[model samples]
Target: MKQRIVWILLGFMVFMSSVVMAAPAENAAPGSRIKDLLAEWRKGDVKPATGNRLPGKVGLVWQPRLDDATDMSEAERIDCINVVSPCWFRISSEDGTMSHAALSPDKDYVKKAQKKGYKVWALVSNSFDPDMTHRLLANPAGMKRAIDEIMQAVKKYDLDGINLDFENIEEEDRDALSGFISRLGTELHKENKTFSVDVTFPGGSPNWSLCYDRGAIAAAADYVMVMAYDEHPGGSKYAGSVASIGWVENGVQAMLREVPAEKLVLGMPLYSRIWKESDGVVEDVETLWMEDADRLVREKKLARVWDADAGQYYFEYQKNGQLCRVWQENARSIALKASLISKYDLAGAALWRRGFETADVWPVLAAELENSQR
Candidate 1:
């Protein structure tokens, strides 16, 4: 009888170990977590939650620096708007300052965009200058001056809103940063104008990502636009997709913890990165627009294969004694991302910058938007 009781206890211990091991780890990738959740859902171990299917709000960032030397014609601009059908256009028209701000809006482009039924919001940035951002956010006088200039520009340009794109700020200025956004949002709301902020993926390193107090800023702003690309940005030693589905999902989940889904916008990349590696070390990297990426694969006669793990098309070749790899972003990959917006009931999706996407993506996005409304 004693031997039998000891054996039973050992069996119970083994079963408990397996149960604990089967649970998802805290540091698991979003894709892994999703897979586990699906398994649980299949067994009816967990209840699935669904978000409301509201009409999706599409946004685009339009930077003048991306235009060609000859500039895009008004007709061309109108045609582009007709194709993408974005609800908001964040024009790169202003840069932040310590004493005052600079405003540069192309009246012609603004007039054309508004006539096409697009809400025009002036985008202000610190040009990713860390020092400038710290100064502007830290000093109370500087913040007031900057806000005054922004309001003046909004009135002068007859704009509908403002998009704050400040980057590379110091971690020490986190509180000040939130304060500035709060004040700006308060003033902008008074004028009946919308205010939005562009933030990077949460859970990043301290200085690079933790600079923005997402909870505070999201509470203050009308929309919190999360730049979900650059999972592997330029200058990184390793090479990977610009934004994999797993990385994006993880980012959205992280932000959702602090922000309401209605006030969140998931930013998508319309481009990919070409990494040049030699002997297992990445030597250089280049950005490729989706159209150009597709063309390159055909021109080089390289085989494109779907990477189930990354959830994107993969292509690699040897050039000049270096191994070149490209994680191509086509309609299919983007469509998957759009589906996430509906699944999470996010506010909407925003394209990184105008002009990098292929025409095929527009229809896919449109379908996703329609599906979301249902």
Candidate 2:
């Protein structure tokens, strides 16, 4: 009888623990959908007003080698005037084996960017935290190890700073991520390297926000890059830009409540998404490259639809009797976003990637920022 009772108690304990772990995060604001939740949060105390600053110059980022190498050119790298080269990504806790495609400053294209006096920064990710974010929530040793490895990489490569891109972490890991970032900021400061984070558009459930502690994250890093796009894609039930104007404004406002305006970098998606209606196949995706966008307009007879609410463009047409949609970025939309930077007094803008920029984007950006003080 005693043995049976003990076994039952053990099982009960296990089940109870599972339930607790599975419960939604505490203080999760109500809303089933991403848009509603974000809207409601914006209505709350997340945003704070601010004094506007001088308009900022535009900064374009290039995610090189990883997406597709066939289209990348040598000349594109050497003389991308007025662009900032953001390294694709480097992973942590692993040995110093860089992936073949991820942009490495030691690599040819990066070297070219450096030679041309373009500003550069190293992008790194534990990316969803892997074992570190979970098992190391309170594990000082593991956190330190991750930090040490990353700082070493930054120094070895002579990077300007690091871009933190950890994503999809569990909620319990939020505090740990904040603690880790605090430590990382200290280390990066010792070497005069800036630290920044890549933030998802603020919405989603407690499940999604579990990994991100906006307050702590903002406090720890020099700047936070809000990826203000990717709201809807080809596979989604609807069509939209990742960051609609309202969404972008509210998200930035949320971050501004905790982070200084000068420390905030608004991320504009230079890419677009595509979805198949009948098949429910959606690709939350990139902008049609200059070459691809041109081919579609000039060669294909599809009509482009402009998303005024979202400040993006898309195409709707029938193929094989199935509806197809393609979302894209062009000189016009890019210019619109750049104008927002000036209007909002944002620190700077980061393009989702490099190389796919419309031929006219640079000229427009340059013209807009030509006389800016910053």
Candidate 3:
């Protein structure tokens, strides 16, 4: 009886080995190609993308210096150390006469990107002027012209598509805005181009300022990037880090109700805001990095505090003997945000700006995303 039992156990072990060997090696699941896209989507970086027809990877800017439009090439602008390809470059008009910090992406940039096989898109934006955007919304002819110019730019630049980034318009203009987007989508579709939009988190009804009529926007866009950060209450009083994890999750979940899961791109902030309290006055310290915060603490002997609710780190530093609380993103937060993307099966996430990422973000991103596939 013992010999028989030993033989059976050996047979079972052999069978298991055979099954493991026969199965395909662990492969990337759906949307794995866009895993790094999480880095770019959250920040609205608008860099080009590569890989299959998956969601975005990272969005990098290809803008040139205001004075010298020809200073840097697309390849030069990209932080290849942490980026995935088919990078999206921001398309802006540069005066041929004067040099602008923004890249003058004409046929040359597009041609170069296409040569390098980039998934390039023209980001049609009017965020620079909220007033102009408002005017464009009210004036049908103006909107039409704006759309036409965008289309023309698309053709001239040989772009993959267009990204609508008009901000701060009156609520009454929602319908008109919807109509404009609808037309843009239709036109882009005819040319086999994509239409994307940068939308704020729609935390359901009532809090309409922060939220949008997400349903309408989703319908109009081929891809919708949910600007999930900035939840920390700003203005008048000191607020914690923008887009605390708790706040971001609620916003993303709320947005999913109206937008298709695959079409949604989650946006995150790479930089942080610190609130300084001095002399009964609260001041904002915006866009500081984690390294800077750490150095100030260790080198400058600043006091530190962690916000449990926000899941972020902060430092209370004295610059010139002025007490200021500095808040910055950390590796933990990046990992958590990436995990959330996988949990929700989101298109991906993008950081607000490149070159501002925390020192630990990239390593954490690469490790967590790779492990998730397993």
Candidate 4:
């Protein structure tokens, strides 16, 4: 019971998780119940809301390799996906200059995705620098520069929208962050482009959780993607699931109190972590794709145990006399998370990044979001 309470208290998951449609209602016909949920969630959306362009199953592209040599692109699975948020832009330099290199080299990639009917939302981030974001938002010019660059990029690339992922912002700058979102959102709406912002669960670390004003954000942006993964991060002192189902559900419920279901996008994880521990103290952590996590299980022949409280499969192995454990994201776990989409009547879901999941996971997600209509 104490463990369950900690599960609910965890805030702001790290790394990235994907989100999308939820599972069919309990003991109900999937075909009918899904339609009912969709109808209810679509009651008041107007012309350019992200939900309008969704089956809302978004697969985030993380600097996918140009030639498809190493990174396996999820573009082929557009059958289950409708939009892609590429990690295309960021303000990483000390001076707050927006970098466009993330998409420059992948120009053709965006064109191809669009050609396949996928809405491409270029992701713009602050590189998670609390100090930098605080300083940048303090200067109106810096904020305008960032927003102007995003507008120029959308027009230049004919992209569908922008996914503003600003993290590590100071709690004092909460209103400033909301102001910036409102400003950018105004610009994007002028061009009829969808604008979405990424936020974490409420109440964990002050900067990550407290800095977000969910009510203001929901009013400014077309959608607010609640990142529901990283319940246990790489730097966490203890080892646990990247995102257990119970934790994610709690996060979504808490968010619904502030954000209307129609504008809330639950972000789920397509990856998992392998924790290397020495006597219960985490020493190192490795992030792996859902497929790689499966491969590691096969290679190590680790036993899979269902931790009912976690809603994930628990497995541990010894390597070089080191204790390694994982709480992997499999199809079943993802499907249960997906069920929350319908359960909550959210706008849609967005995955953290592409290429981190297995082929089997796509089918499950596609089925949950099968009724996704633009």
Candidate 5:
């Protein structure tokens, strides 16, 4: 009888510990943290007001390839921010595990952006390594270690926030992913820092795209940025718009079911894809900046045709018997996307990468932002 009673006590203790572990952190306010942040921002506690900035929130993803000598200089990077006047800048300079990650923050760049009244957030990605992401998310200890390193980096760099961009994760890590975001959000909120996440548009393949628990992530994060591009990514056999209007609309509708429109930041593509097809078979794909797309259009003297279905300009030319097609993203398409922000009452739009856009698109973006505010 004594042994049986002791066994029962151990079982009860285990159950209690499990329950404790499963509960959210004491400081976590999943559903209301973003509301609080916005309220504080409105009170002018976060940063001083600026006239050139957009009324609605806008963000730019900055992914600097360190190995490229031809990459934009610090001056150019700052100019891009000044031109766009985005409220948030997410720098993609860190990747991998807590101990093995690579962090390369350009102090001067950070200072310049901050001086321009932009809040800088450092992005931490899994480097698209599925195995590494699985290892980090599947284990509780690993998650804590990663969060510690991320928080340390956030403090070390004096960053305003962190953007969790863990991609290519296994389907099994869905709950783990939400838990990680919850814990991170709690910690960041304690410091009064923003915590945003980048999730692929829903209704895709299971492990690669649908791994995200969008509703849970929306609750935990200050902003759930839908990476709404890559509708016809490089690996795709078919050639099409990088992000068509129909695709984006469907994605937004699906996400709205899971995330509040106010918490959703529709990600817009600043680039387009050029496809080379031979005999109705796609041979190669190359990503082009807005400027490059225009130059290609001029060089080929290709006649522009409006694709009403895609809601963008389309151009096609044949070179060496290979069909070359370009789905251009100019002021019109960008303006349409910006209008969607107002149409759906979204948080705003986020541009994928900073340098890919042209100057002509900025004014259109600003105008649409003004309209959205009105």
Candidate 6:
């Protein structure tokens, strides 16, 4: 998830039914053939997971910019982060066609990352549109086209796998969404590649929380990257840590009930929010990157104090009688969160984004996850 991909923009049903359809006779009528094929689609071709290539691995959610020279280079040199999931494909059409924006995904960057021993699991997103999602799911032809296109892209690019990052879905579509993931995971597994999904915290708004049938999704995909951030996102009643240690731990524990330890990856947020409050009323929430947070703290002359309970440095200052606050994510905070991977014996850790993290953060991740990653 990127800065633009706000965690606050909240967002599966579990319907398990099976049907049987007989194969069409040779030289059968065109209408009969179409009916038989549609029946087969409804029956579901759920395939077994191929298993994770790097179960205990470190991953980074990549937000591709014009120049990824720095990100690509760092990932190459850093041995800890074994997986690179680039934001690549998008569900662009109501008819389920993926949009190919000019150079949205830099193929050369993919090759470079792979050459350096990174397992490139290119990300496929829903663009956070629920109406479009409803139509895409309703149309069997559209759904088929989308899956075919995704599989084609993987084969064409020789990608190691896929990371499904669908957001802002309606609760009514839970079963439909589960079916989509099951089908996609099946196809991906047939190719002998990893399939994963990005999910929000368990108990939140209906758009983000209730829509995901976590247990069913886990049963389908090879891995599930639990986005443990956004505890206090923008437009919240109060300001708090983007990912407090306690809240993150709770989220991880909640996910573990549904997803297996080896099949779950903890997603860490690299950014924090700078909250401006007046008379205890929230005024504005500004998303802050690691370097930006450091600069703002110095410029505003805010005093930084350690919140042992939250396990993050808290900074607050009064400007013109307005209270400004930030729960800063630093190396210490990241180290504490990374420790959860080991504590819970989880699969590994994945940073929310690439460039948002300060250069110094990677070493902490490497150090903490060294034992966690087998």
What does the lDDT come to for candidate 6?
0.80
Q: Per-residue lDDT tens digits of candidate 1, residues 1-374?
A: 99999999999999966666665443334454544533332221221122122233544444434345212223344321221222222212223342223433665656666776666776776667677666555344445667777788778767777778778878877777777777778778778777778899887876679988898888778788898888898988999998899988988999999999988977888899999999999999999998899889889998999997778999999999999999988889989988888889887777766677777887787777667657
Instruction: Report how far off residue 273 is in candidate 2 (Å).
Output: 1.8
lDDT (Cα, tens digit) per residue for candidate 3, span 1-374: 99999999999999976665554322223243333322222222222222123334433322223223222224443322222122223223221011112444566756665555455665555544444545555444444556566677778667777656555555655555666666667677777777677778764222234324567667666678776666664563765677677888887888889897777777777767667667747765555666665666688776556677777776676665556765567777767776776677766555555445555676776665554434
For model 5, residues 1-374, the per-residue Cα lDDT tens digits are 99999999999999976665555443334335433432332221222111122345654555544334223323334322322212222212222245333435665656665776667766767677677767655444455666777787767767777777778878877776777777777778767777778899887887668788888787777788898899998999999999889989998999999999877888889899989999889999899999899998888777999999998999998888899898888889988877888888887777776668787776787776666666
**What lDDT score belongs to each candidate, Candidate 1 first?**
0.71, 0.60, 0.57, 0.74, 0.70, 0.80
Q: Please write out the lDDT profile of model 4 over residues 48-79, one tens digit for every residue.
A: 33332354445443443344632323335457
Give the per-residue lDDT digits (tens) of candidate 6, residues 36-89.
Answer: 544554444465656555745655655554354456634446667778887778
Misplaced by over 4 Å in model 4 are: 1-77, 93-96, 101-105, 371-374
Indicate the residue-level lDDT of 63 in model 3.
28
Full candidate order by TM-score, most accurate first = 6, 4, 5, 1, 2, 3
- State residue 144's C-alpha deviation in candidate 3, in Å: 1.7
Worst 10 residues of 2 by lDDT: 44-53
Model 1 lDDT-worst window of ten: 44-53
Among all windows of 10 consecutive residues in model 4, the one with the lowest summed lDDT is 11-20
Better structure of 2 and 6 per TM-score: 6
For every model in order, what is the number of clashing pairs? 0, 13, 33, 14, 0, 7
In candidate 3 the C-alpha lDDT for residue 328 amounts to 60
lDDT string, candidate 2, 130-165, tens digits: 554465444444455667777776766666667777
- Cα-based TM-score, every candidate: 0.78, 0.72, 0.70, 0.81, 0.78, 0.86
Model 3, residue 81: distance off in Å is 10
- Clashing pairs for model 1 are none
lDDT-superior candidate, 1 or 6 = 6
